[model samples]
Target: MLGGKSVLITGAGTGIGAAAARVFCREGAAVTLVARREKELAGLTAELTGAGHRAQYVLADVRQRADVARAVAAATEAFGGLDAAFNNAGLAAMPGPMHLVDDETYDSVMDTNVRGVWHCLQYEIAAMLEGGGGAIVNNSSTAGLVATVAGSPYIAAKHAVIGLTKAAANEYGSRGIRVNAIATGATRTGMLGEYLDQDPGREPAMAGKAMVGRLAAPHEIAEAAAWLCSDRSSYITGATVPVDGGRTAR
Candidate 1:
């Protein structure tokens, strides 16, 4: 539980980010939501506040360092300081063979997925240090842990995320900042929906890849993140906790 804690969440307009916002609020944290979609952030903010949860929104594109800095400043200014963060902003890389992938696709995916976290880590770590300590959960994927048919660029970027997570944890763990990552399973988010649409009958096969025989719900992944960012997981850091429904069990 995160009672009275101040939390910041990237990509908070939808999917796991939005779900995390709700879960954190229900657990009593004042959450700051960040994303490029102003309308979605505004709407989610209103929904959280209306439900009697403390929440706010900042419009930002995580790929932009200035945008991320402003969002981080806004969160600290609003809540006094950040106690936790969920760096969940990401993009679904365009699926293609390595030989056929274009530079544009590579840049878009790497910039948003890799560089975006780099930008977030700088500001979030600084803020957490000032607050004496904090927890951070970066959203990696099952692809990060193993090879997948999803696009080489995506796999490479996610693998970079895990490396970043571990390195940060090793560097800051003693300083009271905990950094970890979650290797998520296929989930019913808009991105996955689009992927499934490409092959109308792909959903079941996708689910079958997991031992649980199902794709994860966004909230289920959110719960894992919340725990990672809470005292309940104080001993966890520099680790890639799998929320993949046993997808990587074998």
Candidate 2:
């Protein structure tokens, strides 16, 4: 779907980000992977290139605007231009009740989950505009539509992601940029291993929430995201496509 397009993916060191990195490569896009961990990012980059895919890595903590700006510049310099971006960097805070959630928890979650995307958008949009516009997909969650099994911080941050996506879409779609979000179901990824470890018994209940009776795989969500970033979805914008395996069906 991507052909020779260049794409950037935040949090591309692991989980959904890594999965999407591979998927985009298979679809013929040169992918720029961004994350804080040098070892993980380098390892994934090597793996992709070893497989004959165009991939490279940049070290950046998306919570910081300067870091994100440098990462964007690195991607543009390496790929010539950015044709798309998956603003998917995020954090999963300790699960707890609203009243039980402390200020620190709220700040940390919002810094990475919300502000991270804000920083990414500012830079990626600039890069896209320079390249004559592109596409973006923020990693929203089912929590954005309602409550999460997590905390208020997660829900609030994801809701902000959706808001940002729609606002950007409305502002830039006319100028050839497409911005959208994915309300995703629980996925079997390293990010969710904690919950799975802490309460193995809750698995059935979590799966039951979706009509499909299972969590989505990271690659599944990647496909939905890649489609949105492709020319195939040219006419679509300002929309939240759900990849929740029917978690939001009810």
Candidate 3:
């Protein structure tokens, strides 16, 4: 677990990112939370600080490189250095065949899910190297490993995340940096609301197929992410640990 370290998380206002913020703070890491919504980021910062954990919020869009640079600099100013980060900002658009997906939709998803991660890792790793090295966990998904009911665009972006994690871990491991990913299954969060609304029956049907026979809680994914960010996972890098309810077991 974290102790006296500084951690940064993208899309940290709600759902899994917010849950991970709570976990990291509990583990003793001063957390810098970032999200597109200034309102939600401010609210989360107030809540964490009120609970006596060191937390700060930066308002920026993850898809923009300049904004990401500002966010990382803000973290260094606030905490002196960064020890870890979770590149968790992403989008899940509706399901559609590859040919049917529009250019705008494709670019938007890639901009946030793939390019956003690229910016975060580039800046965060630079900061970590200056501070002697650290750990990183990117939020991938079960969709990255296997085809889901989602569109081909999302799957492609997520698969790219896994590739990035492996590449970064291999390149930086010797330098004391550890990079990994979490592939999560049917965790109930805002990301699922649209699909659930389209067909309520589909959500539970997918949940039943999981080895655990239930939807994973967001905190469950957060816990796995926290472990990856901590010294406890010192031997774990260049790997994608599933936070799924054993959905990948079969």
lDDT of each candidate versus the true structure: 0.94, 0.91, 0.91
| Candidate 1 wrong stretches, greater than 4 Å | none
Compared with the true structure, the alpha-carbon lDDT of candidate 2 equals: 0.91
How does candidate 2 fare on TM-score?
Answer: 0.98
| lDDT tens readout by residue for model 3, 69-105 | 9999999999999999999988998647898889999
- lDDT, residue 191, model 3: 85
**Which numbered prediction scores highest in lDDT against the true structure?**
1
Model 3 off-target regions past 4 Å? none
Question: In candidate 2, which residue ranges exceed 4 Å CA deviation?
Answer: none
- Pick the winner on TM-score between candidates 1 and 3: 1
lDDT against true structure, model 3: 0.91
Could you tell me how far off, in angstroms, the CA of residue 134 lies in candidate 1 after the best superposition?
0.2
* Cα lDDT of model 1 by residue, 21-130, tens digit: 99999999999999999988999999999999999999899999999999999989999999999999999875577999999999999999999999999999999999
Q: Tell how far residue 180 is off in model 3, in angstroms.
A: 0.1
> In candidate 3, residue 239 scores what lDDT?
97
- Kindly list the per-residue Cα lDDT of model 2 for residues 170-206, writing each as its tens digit: 9888788999999988998888877887887777788
True-structure RMSD for candidate 2: 0.9
Candidate 3: minimum summed lDDT over ten consecutive residues — where? 191-200
